[model samples]
Target: MAIDLRDPDESYVSFWRERHMCTLTTIRPDGTPHVVAVGVTFDPEGGPKGIARVITNKHSRKVANVLAAGPEGARVAVCQVDAGRWATLEGRAVIRTEPEAVADAVARYADRYGRTPTPNPDRVVIEITLTRAMGRA
Candidate 1:
């Protein structure tokens, strides 16, 4: 069953606020999953109600995959595991290159990770509008 996280519970919110790593899965043009360890943040105030953002270089494969998926956005999934507790977020992701979007992503990242990431000319943010969330936690 899918959990709607637009109004997530305290436990769900807590899980995201705590420092934890997540694995992002994006689909390649050939229908394969390109999974990678990524630093992500849950922005309850950004994008739609339940948005998850990941920062990456414009040249990254995940960026390419999201862009290649076109205007409708790409199907993406992010999963985080901590011992017996785990959560998976399934959503539609879009690559945002606008300055404001990048700034917001960076700010959220800093808030979550406690450090500002070094600025890169090729930096971009992948904004995911979550549709389904599920897991033990």
Candidate 2:
């Protein structure tokens, strides 16, 4: 019931643009999935080969989940849904603690979510290399 975004129609793009929030899902060590509602930004050129980034802190459960799964683990997916459209981005995440990566994530966060991120080593950026994305118009 999902259509891949490689060929998204106008309605699908419109739906995506209209929504400001989406749920991000990650895998726990027990092989269960965890979902969290988050403010998201659309990367006109992100995901898979484009390097999708999500801003989060080390204290967040999602961060813990991804770190436990390891960088190459295939146990992550990010989903965004509105009334008439939905998209699921499948991928693996790399935990980022480096300052440069954090800076990039902070810039993205402030630009999209309008929140400033104070420098903290405990904060992390989950960079997801999307394998595929499915959306329905």
Candidate 3:
């Protein structure tokens, strides 16, 4: 069944937000998909439409892949799964180092993971503006 992504409820948002780990996939310039285990931060507002934040070392392969993909970066897909449940979110990765963006990312990380992300000059924040969601049981 196909469902409209615009209608994600708070429950759905909270479900994903509470998940401890998620996989983030990005496309390399050559078209190979690189997926990595990552800690994720769901937007405080919560919902299908809110953006998700992820932090990474600026020199990491994921960041390298994003940079190699150019300013628009590659399409990003994030997934959270448990024994009998799963949720995936898809969106374009927005790479930036702006102060506001940095602060937002830091805040999300601290709130969700309870660990402050150390600032790495090489760190780049990826904001996944969710465009879709799907679940399986």
Candidate 4:
């Protein structure tokens, strides 16, 4: 079910904090979805609204898909599940290649996943400024 983005439930918020693999769905140039498993992290300091982030290789197809769409960004959805509970965050995503942005995403990923990812010089961050959230948390 769709949930209010502003008045998010504490349980729902906690669910996102839980460690779980999420599937990021990015649109292909032909309008097909290209979904892949990824470790996602949420940042609550972005603005009035927090954003979800996924760090990946700069040359990854997902990053390519987002770039192929347009400068505004590509529509994307990230979903996670565990047994009977599941949740999804959907929004427009853009590729962030700045060193600071990539480093910040890597740091957040480490904090959430317990270990820093293998250092990759080609790292890039897909920043999703959340527009909607839904789940049965």
Candidate 5:
């Protein structure tokens, strides 16, 4: 369903803010989905709409999938579930390698997951400019 990031449902926002393992789904070059467990952070105040970030190594397959999509970016979704509640953030994802971007992603991840991510020279961030949300949350 459609979602207004500027002022989303409190339940939805609350669920996303909680610490829960999430899954990131990216389309591979063969048009098949490549899903993997990941830690995701959501910032409703990030941009014009909002943004969800996933910090990962540049060599990760998920990163490769996004890169294969090229300039237009890859359509992606970040989802989490617990008990009977769930929520998903869907958007076009881009791989950001700038030091500043990676640092920011780590900070956000720490805030959500309660621990700083391990330092990695090859770190990169997958940024999703959220466009839709759905689930029972």
Candidate 6:
């Protein structure tokens, strides 16, 4: 069963706040899954509201994949695991290239990871509006 993460429990929120690496999966044009390790942040108040954010280069494959999926956004999944504990987030992803969006993503990323990422002129933010969440947090 899918867990409602719109208002995740404190424990789950805490789990995400840790510096665990997450695997992001986006769909390739040929319908294959393109998975990559990414630094992500759980923003309960950002994006379209209650979305996970990933900041990456504009020319990256993941960003291209998301944009290729069209205006409604691409379907994506993000998962983090630590031994016996794991959590998965599945949602629709929208690529944001606007300055305000990028700034918000950068701030949230720094807040979670504790270091400001070096500014990239070609940076883009992938905003995932979760539809389902699962696993043992």
Which predicted model would earn the best TM-score?
A: 5
- Tens digits of lDDT, candidate 5, 49-114: 799999999999999999999988999999999999988889999999999999999999999999
Reference-based TM-score, model 1: 0.94
After the best TM-score superposition of candidate 2, give how far the Cα of residue 35 lies from its true spot, in angstroms.
Answer: 0.9
Q: State the lDDT at 88 in candidate 1.
A: 87
What is the TM-score of each predicted model, taking all chains together? 0.94, 0.76, 0.85, 0.95, 0.95, 0.93
- TM-score head-to-head 1 vs 2, winner: 1
Tell me the whole-model lDDT of each prediction, alpha carbons only. 0.88, 0.70, 0.75, 0.90, 0.92, 0.88
- How many clashes show up per model? 0, 1, 1, 0, 0, 0
Worst 10 residues of 4 by lDDT: 41-50
Runs in model 6 lying further than 4 Å from the true structure:
46-49
Model 4 per-residue lDDT at 9:
84
Candidate 2, residues 1-137, lDDT tens digits: the string is 55454554567555544535778888888888898887544454664234557777789989888778755654677777666667776677878788997887778767766668676767778877766667774
Full-model lDDT, candidate 4: 0.90
Q: After superposition, how far is residue 123 of candidate 6 from its true place, in Å?
A: 0.5
Kindly indicate the candidate among 1 and 6 with the higher TM-score: 1
Best by lDDT: 5
Candidate 3 residue-wise lDDT, 32-69, digit = tens: 99999998876634445667778887778888787787
lDDT of 1 by residue, 29-63 (tens): 99999999998898655555689999999999999
Which pairs of residues have clashing backbones in candidate 3?
Answer: 58-122
Q: Model 2, residue 80: what's the lDDT? A: 78
Candidate 4 residue lDDT tens string, 30-129? 9888999999986654655669999999999999999998999999999999999999988889999999999999998988889998989999999999
Q: Candidate 2, clashing residue pairs?
A: 48-130
**What shift in Å separates residue 19 of candidate 2 from its native position after superposition?**
5.6
Reference-based lDDT, residue 30, model 4: 90
Candidate 2 local lDDT, residue 20 = 59
Model 6's C-alpha root-mean-square deviation from the true structure amounts to: 1.6
Better of 3 and 5 by TM-score: 5
Backbone clashes (count) for model 2: 1
